[model samples]
Target: MAEEFRLRSVAVAVYGPAALFGLAEGAMLPVVALSAIDRGATTPVAALIGALLGIGALATNIPAGILATRVGERKSMLLAAAVSAVGLVLCLVNIGTGPGALVLYGAGVLLIGAASAVYSLARQSYLTESVPLHMRARALSTLGGTMRVGLFLGPFAGAAVMQFWGQSGAYYLSLAAVLAAGVVVYRVPDLETTAEHRAAAAAITTWGMIKRKWRVYATLGVGILLLSGIRQTRQTVVPLWAAHLGLSPTASSLIYGFAGAIDALVFYPAGKVMDRHGRRWVAVPSAFVLGASFVLMPLTHGAVLLAVVAMVMGFGNGVGSGIVMTLGADVSPAVGRPTHIGVWNELADVGSGLGPLLLAGVTALAGLGFGIVVSGLVGFAAAGALWTWIPRPSRGLRPAAVRGPPP
Candidate 1:
């Protein structure tokens, strides 16, 4: 356990830059939506900024998988970070009025998406190599937690720069963050690919490997789909819910940010439990906490009540969201890790993108409480599935299982 802790620490250090890049990846976009509107984009046009970013990410996923396989995950990641840095710099073009601004925004997002995909692949592959299978969950939890931390900080950083120096200042800060992250990555030691991995220069050409493992992936997809929906509801619908019950936007944002901060602090430790006790110990409790939070969130009308709900939600998110990434990394075949992880990340995003839409309908028809309860139920179901059939250490790699790496 001590040795595993040491190794996981090193892995976390390697991922430090990764966390910064991730912060920049998610932080600015939502705020950027506001910027776009200020720059004269219509509400639909402003919303399009976020939609375009998602679409761009979806488009690049396949290509990034191919690139990671051909170029090596390390190289792919470094390039991804560098390109993203450049894209962040391009945010200086705040299309204040015309379609030209929209075009530039689109281009910047496309580049950002391309870079993010490659960056994520490299980080996943790197952690896979650095951490033993037993400790991998904890390591990934730390990394994911960093990303959540970045979420906490990125908006503030962007907003601060914008407040003082304006939008140009914010973009410049974004560039600096990406560049700093890229520099750290470039300074790191090289990650070697296995011979089997080296020989494969293409994206997954044959479906056989993935098809055979369909059960695992399918189960994961369903489970995370639930998690993603929860995340979406929290992001898009929570504010409205708060308003219905009289919570301020500032208070709402704090609730959201606090959850992320708690996740950052708790994920690694929780992951250690996952490594030692078993996934169920973490997965089951995480779901219950999250589900209870959702069921109670709509009912809470005061700050004190909301704070309790947020803390519960954060702890549960740390377990489910952060832990899920680690498990996905574990299940993938080493040779196709980048591509496999890419698909997993994208599937997670499926819930992320669609979750808001589902919440919208729920809020429209049933009300905020209905949406919260349904979303929480989805999380509960996901946890239940993991508990019942996620192939405990009895079948997969855990203390009881042998030392062979996950395929």
Candidate 2:
């Protein structure tokens, strides 16, 4: 058996920037929507600006992967941070400038989204190459854990900055974080220059990689896509559900915050479980539990019950913290892993964008409760798909079923 992988300086180097980047992202996410509204956008338009973040990410996912191949992971990450910093500056400058301020804001948000896509794909690709199969789950999940911590901490930090300096201050905070992240990435060794990574980069074009692994991409990718959609829907519907309940804003924030903490706390254990048993062990339960939470959302009318459901959702989400990325790593050929990951991430981005839109449409036609139920249905459907599709690698040879390069 491969010796147990230990955390190394390199791993820390990769994760540090990701965590900082996520912190900046968390600070900006809430502020951007509010800023758009302040600049005179309608509620729907403001929401669209938020949605554009995911949409812009989706547009760039493929190219980002390819760029990593050409420029190397470290450089790609540095570029991403730099681009995001520029975007943040634009966001601050355009705030309340004029009638075109909202448009400028949307453009800035879109640039940040694209930069984020570049950073995520590059980092995930690096982890897949650097970590061994036996310990891939733990390593990647820890990556998720770091980001969750940032997400949990960022809002409070942003709120503190805004309290003194206003919305533009939050943007400035994000810019500072991104710049710091760039510095961290700059100091890391050029790990992506290893022969194996280089061969993988040269093995096939991104399009060629897709053609070779079309089946895995089509089947497992679709399942993960649904899971991604369900995940995003939970984020959206849960807040709406709280509003529907007429719960105090403070109470709602606390519930979500508590649930987020639950989600972050479980990531390490979830990774351990996946590594010890198999991906399905966590994947199946996560989908079912989260799906059940959505179904239970409308049935409960009180604050306590709503919180319970929310916690359940958090538990489900936590268990699958890095699952989608882990699964991508398992199936992708090491040599061309980055290219395949790009495709995988694109599906996830699609799902993220699709979920809110689906909920909005369903809620518009039916009711909010039913819209949530529809999300629940998607979750259950994803569970069924994952159970059938995730390959069962032999105990002696973890990740074995997915080892060979794509045809």
Candidate 3:
């Protein structure tokens, strides 16, 4: 598997466009928040703009899976890019048009979210069929790492663009990057397909796939849901906790940025470990560490302790970069790969959407401290579930025709 993990031309072609699309998305994140604020939205309303991205993705996930089955990964990505370009244009056009601007901006961003779902699901499905089983983890993990790199760099680039041209100008960066990604998708040679792949895709309706994989979806998939939810909660709760402790916004932002750096640094190595060892090596520890971070949130008093905890949480998240997607790829049937992964991704979105809501509800009923603690407990429980539920690929499960596309 290690030997087979070499980066060939086709892999490069796929990854290249994906990285560009990620760069565009990363650059757009902060801009959307600021743009909404500038459009006369209150602070909470502006925050909702950021939240809409996830909401839109959640709404589109299942449908995107169906679209992928009909049109295939390459075409789906191309369509996504085109739609995203239109969304970016709308955001740019509505730039400072008063309170009504948010409506336009939100709509555009929502459309972009749908496009992202399609692009992501299609690419994941394509990789599942294109890469060998043994090398799959590394390839998918590398894919995750590449997007992180783009995300890391995107803000800096967007900030520079905003500095000169204002926040609205940042949309142009996204627009251009998206177009470039589209070009790559258009020019690159498509991965070869098989009759089984087509038949499986065609036969597997979204609802049918859900019914067929209900057991896995309900069990191991729940672990993934909790994992994703907990991960998102950390992002929201950490900042809220910082505010509760009277940490200045600047200090908190700096701490989070540093932690994100730590997360980005570990991607390739994490992939390597997952491949050589097994999923449990990273999965269980990540769950424990993340859960502990949340539980320990109230225990941190000063800035330094908070920073340390943030770094630990980042490390936990970093190591688990592609775990959800990798596990989804490992378990999905080759015939209806996109549908299975789509449902998996949709479950993930449910977790992500529910996380902040759960924290907010918990905080209102109890205290923020208790809410954090509850989240941590969920993480610990999820860790337990993942360890017990996720099946380990057999030592004898080497690359074979049985693992490949149907003849």
Best by lDDT: 2
Q: lDDT for model 3, on a 0 to 1 scale?
A: 0.82
Residue 79 in candidate 2, Cα distance off native in Å: 0.8
Please provide, for model 3 over 38-146, each residue's C-alpha lDDT reduced to its tens digit, 9 standing for 90 to 100. 7788889888887888888999998898888888788999999999998898788765656678889888989899899999998887776666666677778878877
Compared with the true structure, what per-residue lDDT tens digits does model 1 show for residues 1-407? 63554354454345678667766765576567776776678988888776766676666765676677778666777788788876776666764667787777667766887787677766766666666666767777777777777767877787777788866666777687787787776666665445664675364642644675678768866776666667656655456666776778888888767766776677777888878887778777886777777888877878777777887787777766466676676577756666776777777777777777776778789977897788777777867776765556666743222122222
Score each candidate by Cα lDDT: 0.69, 0.84, 0.82
Q: Write the per-residue lDDT of candidate 2 for residues 208-318, one digit (tens) a residue.
A: 988898998789899999999999888887779989989888989988988898988999899999999999999989999989999999998978999889999999999
Instruction: In model 2, state the lDDT of residue 370.
Output: 93
In model 2, which runs have C-alpha deviations exceeding 4 angstroms?
1-6, 192-200, 395-407
Model 2 local distance difference test score: 0.84
Per-candidate TM-score against the hidden true structure:
0.89, 0.93, 0.93
Mark the regions of model 1 whose C-alpha exceeds 4 Å error after superposition.
Answer: 1-13, 194-196, 200-203, 398-407
Residue pairs in steric clash, candidate 1?
Answer: 95-101
